[model samples]
Target: MRGDSWTESYLRSDIMRESVIYQAILEEGELSAKLTSIPRLLVLGLTREQIAQALDLEIEQVPQVIEGQN
Candidate 1:
């Protein structure tokens, strides 16, 4: 009975893995140290100023680290 229910659910397309784009967005907070800020910015909706404010860093430095990501 349990196996039949699972097979029916799979065939019905109600349970599926997340899309790659959504997975990428979910992984925004997990970039490596070298790619941290920039990749995070690309993956999410936060602006440089907002990120800088949240990080307690200089606003000018945000551009340097997050360049070409826009």
Candidate 2:
């Protein structure tokens, strides 16, 4: 049946990894982690430019994330 096959496929790690939704979730988590680390990096004396380069984020995005923290 279609429902059984869908369930089986969903349970497979390879199939789940190939899913668009799964990829989006992974991207979101990665971004969240990067954003969370910004403050710590700043405290450690890294400049916004350095953090942006280190995290592979936009230079503009670093200030925005910094602003959001306050």
Best candidate per TM-score, number? 2
What total of clashing residue pairs does each candidate reach? Answer: 0, 0
List where candidate 2 sits over 4 angstroms from the true fold.
1-18
Q: Model 2 reaches what TM-score against the true structure?
A: 0.74
Model 2 lDDT per residue over 1-70, tens place: 9999988877886676669787898899999999999999999999999999999999999999889978
Q: In order, what lDDT does every prediction score?
A: 0.65, 0.92
Clashing pairs in 2: none
Candidate 2 has an lDDT of 0.92
- Decoy 1 TM-score against native: 0.40
lDDT score of residue 48 within candidate 2 = 96
lDDT of 1 by residue, 7-67 (tens): 9988666434446566776666443443466557646988877777766667786787766
